[model samples]
Target: MRKFTIALDAMGGDFGPHISLSASSKSLQLHPNLFITIVGDAQQITPLLKKYQLLNHNRIKFVHAPETISMEDDPVSVLRHRSQSSMLVALQLVAKGEADACVSAGNTGALMLLAKHTLKTLEGISRPALVSALPNNRGGHSYLMDLGANLQCGCDTLFNFALMGSVLCEQVEQLSAPSVSLLNVGRESNKGNDTIKQCAEMLSATEFINYIGYIEANELFDGRADVVVTDGFSGNIALKSYEGMGRVFFERLQQAINTTWYSRLLGKVLNPIIKNQLKNLHPDLYNGASLIGLRGIVVKSHGSANESASFYAIEQAIKEIQWQIPACISARLESVLAERDCLSHE
Candidate 1:
C-alpha cells in the first residue's frame, strides 16, 4: 500500500486541536495508507491524542507551530507575514514535499493566501480556485469553482476556472467530457455580463467541453450541468445563501412536522425519507473545499467544521492525493490551453 502524508493545521479551526485530532482519528480508521502530521501547539495536541488513545500511533506525527492566523486576518497580511502560523506551516510542508496534501479547517482568506503564497499556482492557472462538489438532482455531484478565493474575475481567469473545474469533475466525478455551464441570470446567449458571455462563447465553441449554456441559480443544483462556472464574489454569496437556506428550510420543515400531534405522528412515519433527503443537504458532510490549481493537494475545511465535518475534509485530501489531482489538472490544463491557443491562431 502506498503511503500518503497529510499536513494538518490542527490549531486553525473554531474548536482547535481537539476537533482536528478527533477528525484525524476517524480518518485513520478508514484510510490505512494515510499518515498525518499535526501542526499546532504540542501541549494542546498531546492531551487530545491521549484522550483519543493515539499517543503512540506510528502514522501520526506532531509539528509544533507557535502562532495562528485568525479568521479576521487580511489575506495579504497573512501572505506577507505569518510564515510560522499554523496555516502557513501546514502549507509549507506541502511546498517542501514532506506531505502529499494539507488539510486545514481555517479562515478561508488566510488559508487561500497561505496556500497560494507557499504552493503558487500551477502552470497556465492564473489563480487557484476554491472548489467543492455538491450533490445534484441526478444523484451526481456538480463541481462549482472560485467559491470564495477570488472577488473579481476576468475572461481568461474565468476560462482557467472552467478548465480546472472541468478537470476536477472528470478526474474525481469520473465523467467523460462532462457538461459545462456558465452560472448566469438567464440561459440566453447574450444574457450575462461581457465576461460571462465571452466564457460561454469560448466554452460552447470548445470541442472538448460539453458546453450546455447558461444555468440559472434554480437549475444549477439540479444537475443541469456537471460544472457550474462563476467568480468568487457571486459563487461565495450563492453558496452561503444555499447553505443558509438549506438550514432554514430543514428547520422549518421539522418545526412543521412536529407542530401538532398528528404532524408529529406523521413525521415519525416519514422520518427515514426526510432524513435521506436531509443527509445530502448537510454542509458538514461536504465540509472541505479544494484549493484547486495548487502544486500540491490542499483542502480547506470550514473553520466551523465539527468532528465529522473535519473528517470529511481529510477524506477529500486522501482522494486528491490518491489521484494526484494537481498533476492531472496540470496535464489537462496544458492540453486544453494549447488547443485553445492553436484555435486562436487559426
Candidate 2:
C-alpha cells in the first residue's frame, strides 16, 4: 500500500489545534498508511498531542510555525508578511513535495492567495476555483464551483469554471459526460446578465462539454445537472443560503415534534428514520471545499468545523491525492483548449 502524507494547518480555524489534533489522531488510527505533518506552534500543539497520546507517534511529524493567519486578517497583508504562518507553512509542504496535500480551516482568502502563489495554477488554468459537492435529491451529490474564490468573473473565467467543474464531476463522481449547467436567473437563453449569457453561448458551442442550458437557484439540488457553474459571488451566496435553510428546517422540525404529547411519541418513531435519510445532507459531511485548478492539492475546511468535520476535510485531501485530480484536470483542459482552437480557425 502506498503511504500518503497530509500536512494539517493545526492553528487555523475557530478551535485551532484542539479540533485539528483530534481529527489527525482519528485519521491516523483509521488509515494505517497515512502520515500527518502537524504545522503550528510547537508549544501549543505538543500538549494537545500528548492529550491525544500522539506526542511521539512514528507516523506523525510536527513542524513548528511561529505565527497564524487569523480569520479576520487581510489576505494581501498576510500574503506579504506572514510567510511563516501555519497556513502558509502547510501549503509550502505540498508545494515542495514534502506532503501529498494540505488541509486548512484558515481564512479562505488567505488560503487562496497563498496556494496560488506557492503552488501556482496548472498549465492553462488562470485561477483556482473552490469546488465542493452538495447533496441532491437524486440520492447523490452535485458539484458546484467558484464558491467564494473569485468574486467577480469574466466570461472566459466562467467558461473555465465550467470546464473545471465538469472534469471534477466526471472524475470524482465517476459520471460519464456529467451534465453541466450555468446557474442563471431563469432557464431561458436571454434570462441572465451579459457575462452569464456569453458563458452560456460558449458552453453550448463546445461539443466536448455536455452543456444543458441554464438552471435556476431553486433547482440546484434537483439533481438535474451534475455540475453547476457560477461566479464566486453568486455561488457563495447560494451556498450559504442552502446551508442556512437546512439548519432552519431541521431545527423547526425538531421543535414541532416536541410541541405536543402525541407529537413527541410520533417523533420517537420517526427520528431515527429521518436522521438516516438526511445524514447525507449534513453540512459536516461536505465541509471540505477543494481549491481546484492549482498545481497541488489544497482543501479548505469551514472555519467552524469540529472534529468530525475536520476529519472529513482531511479525508477529502486523501481522496484527491489518490485521484491525481490536478493531473486529470490538466489533461482534460489540454484537450478542451485544443478543440477550442480548432473551432476558432473554422
Candidate 3:
C-alpha cells in the first residue's frame, strides 16, 4: 500500500481553529493510515487538538508556521513576502514532494497563485480553472468549471474545462462519457452573449466532449447537464446565487410556519423530511473545488467551511489521489493540444 501524508492549512478559514481542528480529527478517523501535518501557530492549534483528543496521535504532527495570510491579503504580494504563512507552507510541502497533496479553506486566489507558482501547471495547460461539484435536485451531482478562477475565458479555454471536467466526472463520480453542457441564456444554438455563443459553437465541434448544446440557468438544478463549462465570472455568480437562494428559500419556509399555529403543526409533521432534504443540498457536501489544469490535486474549500465540510473535502482529495486523476487528465489534455497544433500547422 502506498502511504500519503496531507498538509492541512490550520489557519485558513473564517471560523479559525475550530473548523481546522474538527476537520483534522474526523479525517484521521476516516483514514486510519492517513498522516496529517497541521501548519499554523501552536498557540492557536495546540489547545484545539487537545480538546478534540487528537493530541496523542503519532500519525499527526504540528508544524509551526509563524506568518498568517488573511483573506484580504494580495495574492502575489503575500506569496512573496509571507514565506512562512501557513497556507504557503502547506503548498510548499506539496511542491517539494513532502506531501502528496494540500487541502486549504483559504483565499481562493492565493491558493491558485501559490500552486501555479510552486508546483507549476500540467503540460499544455495555460490557465487553471476551479471546478466544483454541486448536488442536483434530480439525482447524484453535477460538475461545473471555471467556478471563479478566471473572470474571462476564450473558446479554447472553455473547451479545456469541459475536457478536464469530464475526466473528473469519470474519476470522481464514476460516470462515463458524461453529458457536458455550456451555460448560456437559452438552449438554442444562437443564444447568450457573444462569448457563450462562440464557445457553444466550438464545443459543438469538439470531438472530445459529449456536448449537450446550451443549458439555461433555470435548468441547472434539473440536472440537464453533468458537466457545465462557462467563464469564471458568470459561473461564480450563478453558484453564489444558488447557495443564497437555497438558504433564503428554507428560511422563508420556516418563517411561514412559525407565524401561525396551524402552519407550525404542519411544519412539525414535515420537519424531519425537510431537514433531510436541506442537508442533502448543504454547501459542505460540495466542498473542495479542484484547480483543474494543475499537475497535482489542489482542492479549495470554502473560506467559511466548517469541520464536517473540511473532512469531506479531504476525503475527496484522497479519492483523487487514489484514482490518479491528475495524471489521467494530463494525458487527455496532451492529446487535445497535439491535435490543435497539427491543425494550426496545416
Highest TM-score, which number? Answer: 2
* Each candidate: RMSD: 1.5, 1.2, 1.9
User: Poorest 10 consecutive residues of model 1 by lDDT?
Assistant: 200-209
lDDT of 3: 0.85
Q: Write the per-residue lDDT of candidate 2 for residues 1-346, one digit (tens) a residue.
A: 9998999999999986899999998999999999999999988989999999998899999999999999899999999999899999999999899999999999999999999999999888888999999999999899888899999999898888888888888888889999999999999887999999989889998877899999999999999999999989999999889878888988899999999999999999999999999888888898899999999999999999999999999998988988889999999989988998888899
- Candidate 3 local lDDT, 146-167, one digit each (tens): 8898988988788788889999
Candidate 1 per-residue C-alpha lDDT over 1-346 given as tens digits, one digit per residue, 9 for 90 to 100 = 9998999999887877899999889888888888999998777878988999788899998888988888888878878877788888888999999999999988888887778878999988878889898878888898888898898999888888888888888888788989888889998777989999887777777766678889998886898789998999999888888778877988899899989999999999999998987787787777889999889899998888889889999988888887889998899877887897998899
Q: Which regions of candidate 1 deviate over 4 angstroms?
A: none
Model 3 CA lDDT for position 54: 76
Alpha carbon lDDT of residue 72, candidate 3?
Answer: 93
Q: lDDT per prediction? A: 0.87, 0.92, 0.85
Model 2 misses residue 273 by how many Å?
Answer: 1.2
Residue-level lDDT for 119 in candidate 1: 94
How well does each candidate superpose onto the true structure, as a TM-score? 0.96, 0.97, 0.93
